[model samples]
Target: MLNKSYQQRLEHDLEGWVKNGWVDRQNTGAILADAARGSSSTKIPAIIGILGAILLAAGVVLFVSANWQEISKLTRLLLLLAAMWFTFVVTVWLKRTSHDYLLEAILFLGAAIFGANIILIAQLYHIDNHYPDGLLFWAVGTLLITLFLRSRATLVLAFCLIVSWASIEILEFAQHPFWPFLPVWLIAAGLAYWLSFRFAIHLAFLSFMAWFFSSIDLLIKWSGFSDSETGGLIVLFLLTSFIYGLVMERKNSPLSLGFGDALAHYAISGLLLIVFFFQVETIEFDGWPATLPFVILAGFAAVLVLGTFIARSQKIFNLTDTALFLGFSTWFILSWFIPALNHLWLQAAIYLGLTIWLLIFGQKQYDKLLVILALIAFGCQVFYLYMETLGTLLDTSVFFLLGGVLLISLALGLEMLRRYLERTRDPQDSRSQEVAS
Candidate 1:
């Protein structure tokens, strides 16, 4: 499937070709129409179909629920099997008839039916094993279907089941790492590899991120810590290390797929967002996390950083990236000793600094989107800092007067800067294949 970046780039390139007179003006529409016809990644129709499928699945489930007492248990079991198989047969027929659009939605519906069958079957038999096992069964079954069909839609279905299963299992069973989750996630990743699906690979990346954060949450709890803030910092540091590995490895699909440096883009944006959320004061922690998890996670980060430095370091991830993360981790790590560094204002300051650095870096990289977002983040952090100050100094009217003026100027400046950057980074700047979009 063509990615959104490639889709937009293709449109831009087609226009450029027409302008250069390499293609006939009248033929441009036909060419683009042909391209659109071939591209399977178009979301609108698929999204609509998936929504319809969900509603259809829901209707079937609701119908079953509404008449459960009227039917025998055997009838209920057969009804579910028939519904699941009907969707699968439809998918196969769609494939054979070359109906690509509806094929995905049918496959999605089949997976949904199969998933519902797990629960319905359990209730029918009155079997009383751990119910998360039902979700686990659904996950494995959907994963197999995904692999067999090499369907991105079913891969998504599999991932949804995995996440739902983990959520239930973790919340029900106390901090049990849910270690079986690892193999299921790995299988999902393998499906991406098997099909060479770029979007599926991104789903894999997200799956890993969820598992990483959940595992860290459990680790913090096991170490006898309840402090949410400290755990956030630790997760950020470890995540940075993970991102470093992703950047250094430079994983990509086949050249035909046109997936370049997407991991780096996601990693960079992810780090910025993580740091930005750190300053939000709504979440409170009881106390600091135990030193053991912090030290162990830091050491794990050190090993990753060190390995990257050893293996063609600057070629992929550079010195500045290392230094920035080092500074970020050091701030919270030292808070354990100094305590003063843990102030909200100080956290906001560092996030502001990081925002500024990102703007400068994006300027150098010619990533207009990055610069625009960084400007927004910078303005937000400033506002957050001002609000924090207001909470303490509400008795002094003078502070609010000054803050009002500063905030108005900041807001106007941010809007102007973002619009200017967007105008400048238009069709000309988007000519690069590196994906300015």
Candidate 2:
């Protein structure tokens, strides 16, 4: 939902546009209505309801914990069961009343209590040997509720539970690959498609990513740590995901999605985070070698980039979009293949160049969040560079001075570009944003 301040700003700008003869005065109201429609104002009560449910659940747990010594097993079980049934009753009432969001919250609470009751009863019966199994049971039960209720909230909860279950199995029980999770993620994806919930799609993707990253050790067990740098592999994965987002976002492409922007944002954030680790120069950099995983990863990333390049409708290279990807991809692959490109100085230069590219991207796209992200990333990079490279006061002082000037210059350029873009932005584009929102 858009903030009130942002809405006010948009309204002010719309009025100016109306006065400038750029937009018809009569259409302004319709435009504002579209922008304000389906916003958080209507959803806030439902959110509060859900949050209250969660808080109530937490409080109940705390009470149970506090009275654990005093309460008998049967009484505790009965209490949890009663609470679970109570929520189900409330769910029926809300459903009859057509309070969908409240019904969802009640159902979610029931699901939580159901999961808790399972393990609690198991503990009482002395069958809670494998706690991770409890998580799986909880996830499965939640998914059943999700399926029956066709709830967005419960679907998300199920996704989280399943991921937690798989994570615990892998981390605590040495369950290799977590094979069952793949099918479960597919189920979640299918359900998301059926529901047409964009956030659920994000959760599905995240669950899959979690499964892959968590199972990396077991998936590559034969190679051992000597055969690969996990960091390099992760960076490659992120790069590939970024490219996939770009490819999927292409309007003319066969595959397109409304959620591709979110995926691209995640990949960009991951890339910047890795660059942060790079600048620190202390996050277990083993110097990627020509290993099997490296070769596979690099090849996969290359294929993605090349495939998209071949499919790109624009004959001219778009630096604003592709610059950051190309810079990082070249450095990442060449750093191992060509030793000369592996130096820290070159890496810094590449990342520095990427920061500027991201700034331009943000301005060109009229994304204030991305602009803010770029600024924060640049500031962090500078701070880390200064901290890592210490010297005599005069040398350090001069370096800081130059860095400040460079940063200020970038900021000015970003502001000027932002204004230019704002002026040139078509009325249709603003309407498109409202529709997208």
Q: Which candidate should be chosen as best, given TM-score against the real structure? A: 2
Q: Itemize residue pairs with steric clashes in candidate 2.
A: none
Q: What is residue 326's positional error in candidate 1, in angstroms?
A: 6.0
**Pairing residues by index, what is the TM-score of model 2?**
0.76
Q: Scored by CA lDDT, what does every candidate get?
A: 0.70, 0.73
lDDT of 1 by residue, 338-399 (tens): 55666775676577766766676567557686687788888887776676677566533454
Q: How accurate is candidate 2 locally (lDDT)?
A: 0.73
Candidate 1 lDDT at 264 equals 47
Per candidate, the number of residue pairs that clash is: 0, 0
Query: CA shift at 267, candidate 2, in angstroms?
Result: 1.1
CA RMSD per model (angstroms):
7.4, 5.8
The per-residue C-alpha lDDT of model 1 at residue 289 equals 49
| Candidate 1 residue pairs that clash | none
RMSD of 2: 5.8
